[model samples]
Target: MTQENHQKKIITNEDLFDHISGFKLEVKKTVDDFKSEMKESTNDLSNSILRLESSVEDLRKSTLEGFDMVFKTIDDTNSELREELKNDNIILRKEMNQRFSVVDKRFTIIDDRLTVVDDRLSSIEDNMTYKHQLSPKFA
Candidate 1:
């Protein structure tokens, strides 16, 4: 009976140690799985950020091109307007000079007629003085 009791009591600390070791291995596997899932999530977020950045850059370039085209159109319009104004000014000056020349010619003709009238009046005054000197004396 004593020998049989010794054989049944053979369960010892080594068996407990084996059970604890198996439980630790399962916990380590769970931690490794969680780490792999976090790495995948981070990679997805990085890809989305890169795509957003590229889209923003494209928008900026398109906006700059539109503004450049508008500025060039305004400059062209301004240049055309300036040229038209210059042509109008030149035509106005030419017309004014022609009118002034016509007026000057008319004034010169009037001045010549006035000079002839002055010479005729001077001869009439000389004939009246000669008649007064030849009259007979009064009694």
Candidate 2:
């Protein structure tokens, strides 16, 4: 009976060792599967980030292009307005010069008429002084 008990104890120890080995293999397989799943999740996140970055870049470019077009149109309109104002200023100056020329001609004619009237007044004064004998020679 003692010898049989020793043999049974030996078999129990062997069975325990086999169970431990099987548990080790299962743990290794579970760790490998977890690593693969984590790697796949990380790759997916990286791809999504890249796509989001690309979309943001595209939107930025389009917005800049729209702003550039608006600025260019404003510049063109400003240039046109400046040119029109210059033309209007030039036309007004020409018209003013023409009016000044006509006014100058009218002033010259008035001056000539005033000179003739002054000559007539001087002759009348001389005749009146002689008829009245109011000169120094008559006194």
Candidate 3:
């Protein structure tokens, strides 16, 4: 009976209130710490996202600049090639015209020589016919 009485526990109102108050304080502290850690983690994630976005934007700008340079180079090269082709075409036309003029002059000279030779051959034929009619040996 004495051991059973010693084993029984007694709780006072003041002691219970104090214990409950202390437990409430500990729980509030734990909750505040958890909220603070979550806030820090959220801020870190946001910063990482911002950095990734900035890197992507920078890469996009660089790629566009590179493309612009390539297009400009192509345009400049095309313009130069077009101008060169035009000049070559002009030069070729001039050379062909000069050659054609020289050919025309040669043909004119040949035509004149052929006309003179034809006249001479006609005169020789007339003289041969007269000789044949008078000599009577080529009838």
> Which has the greatest TM-score?
3
lDDT of 3: 0.95
Candidate 2, residue 92: lDDT = 92
lDDT of 2 by residue, 24-64 (tens): 99999999999999989999999999999999999999999
Better candidate number, 1 or 2, judged by TM-score: 2
Runs with alpha carbons beyond 4 Å of true place in candidate 3: 1-23
Query: Alpha carbon lDDT of residue 69, candidate 3?
Result: 99
Taking all chains together, the TM-score of candidate 1 against the true structure is 0.55
What tens digits encode model 3's per-residue C-alpha lDDT throughout 1-139? 8877775556678889999999999999999999999999999999999999999999999999999999999999999999999999999999999999999999999999999999999999999999999997888
**Structure candidate 1, residue pairs in collision:** none
**CA lDDT, every model vs. true structure:** 0.82, 0.89, 0.95
TM-score-based ranking: 3, 2, 1
Q: Which model is ahead, 1 or 3, in terms of TM-score?
A: 3
- lDDT string, candidate 1, 18-79, tens digits: 87888888888888888888888889889988988998998999889989989999999989
Using lDDT, rank the candidates from best to worst.
3, 2, 1
